[model samples]
Target: MNKRAIIIGAGVAGPILALQLKKIGFESEIFESRSEGNTREGAFLGFTPNGLNVLKEFIDLDMLQEDCTPGSIKFFNSKGKQIAKLDTAYQKQRYGVETFQLKRANLNKYARIAATNAGIKIWYDKKFVRYHEANEQVTAYFADGTTASADIMIGCDGMFSEVRNQLFKEVSAIQYTKLISTGGYAKIPELSKPLDSIRMTFGKRGFFAYSVSNNGEVWWFNNYFREQQPKPHEIEKTLKTEIQDHLASVHKNDDPLFSKIIKNSHEIIAYPIYDVPKLLHWYKGRVCLIGDAAHGISPHIGQGASLALEDTVVIAELLKSHKDYETAFRIFQSERQARVEKVIKSARKVGNTKTKTNPIAAWFRDRFIGFFIGKQIQQLDWIYGWTYSNKNSH
Candidate 1:
């Protein structure tokens, strides 16, 4: 009998996981809490070569590159002096894929379209409440008074995952990282020309990064230190104008270009950064967690989406080789836990640099930032060069 899997969440991991499972002759369904076609939830994000490789299995690179731009990052200090740079062209030569940046909504749209074309069923507005395991079958209960039973249940529900909460009963697993990020899109006439690389500035007060898309739109974000995490209501009620004014003030001491970008942005959004701490386990019974549900990494390294993509590929491959669902889930955790934890730690360490520092420390950082960045880039082969091979697992 073919194994039937019930996937929670319709985000990046869930849909892609469904497609991968289908390729291996397993049946799967995706349940999402959000309504269909309403994917405009976040700002733009970058796709590293590792993540792009997993995506390319299902999506054509040319189709995914539409409206996006290849991203080679150029770093600058507060005084607008170049400090370091990451060459995407060189990255392509080494990793077989170039890093690209695009709107979050566009990526989700492509994933959904690909899943639908593959004849996978995705149920929207189905909020997962809980699940039960008995008689070697796992059944999921939704808020809509419906139930779905499958041979295995996988959670791709993201950072604040309900499935994760139900599995471990650990409401405190997700922790705030004492950082807030705000970003927006702007159309600057003078800066309309597209550049080969994105510009990132370690400003006096915060870290700011911006890139020009293929269509001449400037996508930018600012990461700032906040001692206290903002209340959810506060974030929701804050007006775009208020955020713009605050960001402009934050970067006032830095280059004048940041001020111009903030002033010209038509809309702005803000969110607090959060990450999942290490868990003792990622599965129980026939239920397992993948993606952000398993380990949530902050945006400091731009690997959150990529890590999730990697999880899907690994889990799908493991399930294909291991007939026992429990063994498959166990091996999945063993294979992924160490690498994912390392990424989380790296992201946290990098995030700390964005926080407020003393004058001496700041000066030292500015003076030696390029050297540190160069060393880090040299050590990135393990990250960008990772590829899954089923033969190696046995």
Candidate 2:
């Protein structure tokens, strides 16, 4: 029971996995490529019941919910006409936890704190270069010329994972979905009333979404079609003014509030979205992939973070019950691949709805979207209601 493991990337998956592994007699060391205090890239994300249940095992739900807004979503057409709504309160009644939205930085901070407090070591600035698996052990090589070996190695390094690349050299590259998302927080006093729902719009030129937290901060984002994939450096070098201008123009015709939110936002970040192709295998020898490293989904479904959290629980549970690491890794992939692929496919379909559409199609969508949303909610019972303990029950 004194096995040691190496987890790459201290993102949502790594820290939670470390904590879960610790509970089952496994010592884990997490290695993150970025240096400490560098978790300021992404905007906010949603936490569904499935993901929250996993976090609740080690972290306080109230602490995670603090400063977050209710995740109930309201949809609208270009003219600002309400189209549909998701009753998250009903979801809470069904799943035992309500959905909420919070900044990515806050979740990262809390997760790392929980892992470290539980005595798990996290090594920052240790970019994983490659790993060598032999004879029941895996040795992870870092870009900093340091090496760490463990009985098992897990990749939580995310979409462009070096671990996944090294694991399957012949696999196809991650696919760019040709969509650019930009968002930031803004202080809009007049619009700061807690709406208890994220307002989403199918704008004339793009898709926009916004919500107000109890703390009076307006959290918002927009998605637009980008035919060519943006370069990493290009996204990094893009100025806040440029993003603000672009968003202001895109959402100009939809709602005045959308433009106001953009004008007031001091900081804006933009990045092109990418999707990971299906893998034939998620594990090899003593090393394995989990979370985004294994399957990356679009943000349209709001299941990306939640799915990653679910992976941590499933893998940890399997590793504890299985006799060998190889068996556990195989079962983990088998148990997860189909469900994750279903989610990835559904997310892609949802993302497609956000893209540019003809006026006729948009008109039909505005009217019928409510019915479709209601059906989707009924279909999502399996996702929100799922739990690691009931894996076999399903």
TM-score of 2: 0.95
CA displacement after TM-score superposition, residue 228 of candidate 2 (Å): 1.6
Cα lDDT of model 1 by residue, 1-394, tens digit: 7889999988888899999999888899999998996776767788999999899989887887778866788988777888888777878788888988987788888898899999999999999999999988899999999999989999999988999999998543677777777788889888798878889888877778888888898888877556777777778786455678878998899878888988988767677788786788899899999988988889888898999999999998898898888898999998888888888888888787777557787788878877887788787777888888765666
Against the correct fold, how does model 1 do in TM-score?
0.95
Please list the residue runs of candidate 2 whose C-alpha ends up more than 4 Å from where it truly belongs after superposition. 239-242, 390-394
Predicted candidate 2 versus true structure: per-residue lDDT over 1-394, tens digit per residue: 5999999999889999999899889999999999997978567888888998888877888887778988888998887788899878897778778889988888888999999999999999998998887777899999989999999999999888999999997884888888867788889768868777989888887788989888888888877566778776767775446668878997777779889998988667676789888889999898889988899888887898899999998898888888688989888888898899988888888788777568998889888989998998889888898787735622
- Per-residue lDDT value at 236 in model 2: 71
TM-score of each: 0.95, 0.95
96, model 1: CA deviation in Å?
A: 1.3
RMSD of each: 1.7, 1.9
Candidate 2 — worst ten consecutive residues by lDDT sum?
385-394
C-alpha positional error of residue 242 in candidate 2 after TM-score superposition, expressed in Å: 4.1
